[model samples]
Target: MKILKYIKTNVLIYFLIGMFLNSGLSLIKPLLLERLLVIQEDQLTLDMVLSFILYGFCLHLIFYSTMLLANFVSNNLQRHLQLRLKNQLFRKLFLEDAFIDDEKVSIVTQEMELLYDQFFLPLDLIIGKSFILFTTIVFILWQNLWLGLFFVAFSLLRPLPQWLMNSRLNNSGAAFSKNQKNFHLSVGDFFRGADTFYFYGVAREKMSMLEKYNEDYENARWRNEWTNNIVFFFNGPIEFFSQVLPLALGLVMQERGAELTTAGLIAMYIATMNINGPLQSIMYSVSDIQRSGVVRERIFSILEDSSVEYSYHTVDNVSELVLENVSKNIGERILFQNLSLNLSQPSKVLIKGASGTGKSTLLRIIAGKIRPDTGRLYVRTSKGEEFSQFQGNIAYISQHPFFTHGTIRDNLTFGQEFSDKQLLYYLDQVGLTGEIPSILDYHLINNGENISGGQRLRLELVRCLLREKDIVLADEITAALDRENAKRVRQLLSSLPIILVEVAHHIDSEMHYDQMINLKDYR
Candidate 1:
């Protein structure tokens, strides 16, 4: 119903009109023939024939035109739903990142599309076809009572096999959905880390793993396809009966000297053919209904779940951030234990070691990106009112900074309401003034591709400076720069009043810091 709930009463009015037109169109031939044979007492006239022909044409005209309008309305609704769902999922993936695991990317891209196709599409079909079927059945009963009763009895039997195998079919669909997502995620990982695999001489192994995932997906696909085949196999005979028997039995009754007129028998045949498509739709729609039900359940699990809590309290007049006896263990490996530190004033700290020394991880904890396993993280205010944590108060620059798809200025300022003057000033400070050809409006295609690596770092620096947070966490900001520019960046950071935590292997030895954390000695 959540899927159907989107079709507002106003648009639903048009959709219902579409269904009504479809139902009305099914009645045209039957009524026309009945009027000629029975109502006119077999004294059919040229004027009567011509009148019916024109009237039938007009009904078809309205039907097709209303159908077009209904299609446009449904499409607009689908697009709106896609946009709204994408925005919510984007926030979940990027903002509330605590819920992110291996399947996050796959869920955001693949499952979103799945939800659209499997859930909403089937509901749309059901709305259109169900009304047509209901209306046609009513007309059938009005025209020939015995035939109508027989048709209804047979149509009910169409779902017997479907009901029996409902659980098996649903399980098959759900398993395939899971396999498809897992396969995509694995393929994405293989592509993203191709260089790493190549360096390790494990490229072949990665390919084999991808092949395994592909095989798993293929197995699920084949199983689901076979299950569908079995369902349709049962449905095939019933559909054949529904489509053919009404016309057959009506003709048989006429041969047996039934009271049915020649025109009436022809009308009944036309009526049966007209109702067949919608009847088949009603039967086949069960599978789609079940599939969508499963998909809806999956989507609801995500939207209804709020296990990841983000409590960011931006404290006023906060001069010091303290971590008391903090310890963290990632799996079996310990990253930090009893890591107590005090930052009461503007300070410069450089954290550095080998790659696995948890330098970035430590900075992440300070920035509230992760929690310490054993100890408390606190931001002690100057007024002695300590808050739970800090996320917004600290500006972070990652080793590989990322940007959303947008212009240079869009990525630089983020969502901050800043003027052109503020932007240009920060760009100037980071020495990225003439480097960007379009200046503030430079179009950054695919995460700042128009800019060089050094320019990317400078752009990040500009964004950081614009924030003006009390603490700046810079992780390998100077990694992409040459000696001269790197020195300039280091010196610029040291001169700032904000507490700076820099993690770099290529540190400027001449630059002075209030504290130094060489992870080799600290560990």
Candidate 2:
């Protein structure tokens, strides 16, 4: 039943009813018009003619009202479905710790927009055109079996164009979408780093890259347009056949002396013309349906792909973290090998390493952002059992801190329930209390753009303090701070009861640390 659920079910009954009424109205008009012309002298009366006209008008009114209702349902269903899918994508991108390549992420984001459009609009066409096609086929059979066969045979010709257009449109649209993302990304990179370009005197070089990206996009767009135009041009011939073929067939029957009256022949022609409307509708709908299929497939690929699974394993109360025989290799290059370390709670340790010595990689492995191929990460619990866990009792901060758009206080609290007194205490400890003289409600842009780099770093440090995590892993927390502020940060970190494992380039020997692990010595 869940599989059967779709936008069509919401308004399908109303659409079907409208279609039947339209077919009935179409069938009656030709017969009534023919009788009126044939029996103009005596067989037809003004009152009878007036009654038929009124009946036709009423049928049209009902059909139009149902169409309005159907449209409303379709629009509502599309809005709901698009929102649902977008929400799912947002969750997967932001919440799930999946190893997604940057290029793949860009491709998926572009495809998501296409999926939203297809779900909202093309779904209606798919449903509506399918119904029309079905009704047309049934009507044709009922009118005349042999004529229906002929019409069906001619209609099959439309599918050739449909197949050809569908094959090219999907491939071209995907290529166009990919090229468009690259073009936009290239333009954005150029503008975002304009200062760097000026400093290096490479403005002309960047401009050349932009031109190349634009040219690639243009070629892709032209290919897509050419394919679509071919489909459109082919549709014109199909439309002509839908009308002219039926009329020509009626004339042949009359010339053959088949006992067909003039009105009957005209009625048959009208019925045939009615079939053409649905046929054309079907062709357009097929194109849309194919496009939507591509989008749907792309979306599903992301949602269904296997990600690194996290075990729900946890500890009662973590007191220490241990990394045993941990080894990491990126492609053919070894980052770290057989490395072992222990970090005990209520203790401070400094990790001293030069650039490119796997300091950041180790932090990522501990944070559960990246998984090691061969290793066991154990958490020593208060119960005396070393439990292997992925994410718990740890808060790791990167060199570049991410701050949401908000005031200084908002960035520190991070939406947690914290008292103003507690907030002030942490800010005062980090030497940011002097930055804002007034109350802590001053608005700041996202990523703390209004504040200095040192101030933002201090704010992030305070945020980590507020989390009250069991273990803290910081990467160059004092890199941007002045000597005085850096001392204050060092003092604040020394006072925390949580286990602190820091990656630092400049570690003052005077600063008290329980242990100093040198990565260079391990290698």
The TM-scores, one per candidate, come to 0.81, 0.85
lDDT score, candidate 2, position 120: 41
Best by lDDT: 1
- Candidate 2, 1-523: lDDT as tens digits: 2212333564546554544444443344555555555655665778877876886677667666656665665566666655655655565565354434453455356666666554445556556655555655665556566655666566656667867657677888677766776886787688979999989999999999999999999998798768767887886687567556855776787698766567655555565666556666666655554545645665666555556234334456788889898988878767777878787778888888888878888888887767887877878877777866736567777668877777767777767799999988888888778777753787778567777888878777877888677778889987887888888888888888888888887788657888887777655
Q: Candidate 2 at 500: error in angstroms?
A: 0.8
Q: Over the stretch 1-523, how does candidate 1's per-residue lDDT look in tens digits? A: 5544434576567666655655564666677666656546376778877987787687678766767766776676677667766666665466455444566665776677777676667666777777666776787777678876666666656667778899988888777877787798888799989999999999999999999999999998799778878976887788667657766787788789887677766665566655666655654666655655555676666665665434555666767878788777778987667777777758887887878778888888888867778778777777887876667778898867887788877887777798889989888877888666768777777776766899888888888888778788989888889888888788788777787888877557788977777776644
Q: List the residue pairs that clash in candidate 2.
A: none
RMSD of each: 4.2, 4.0
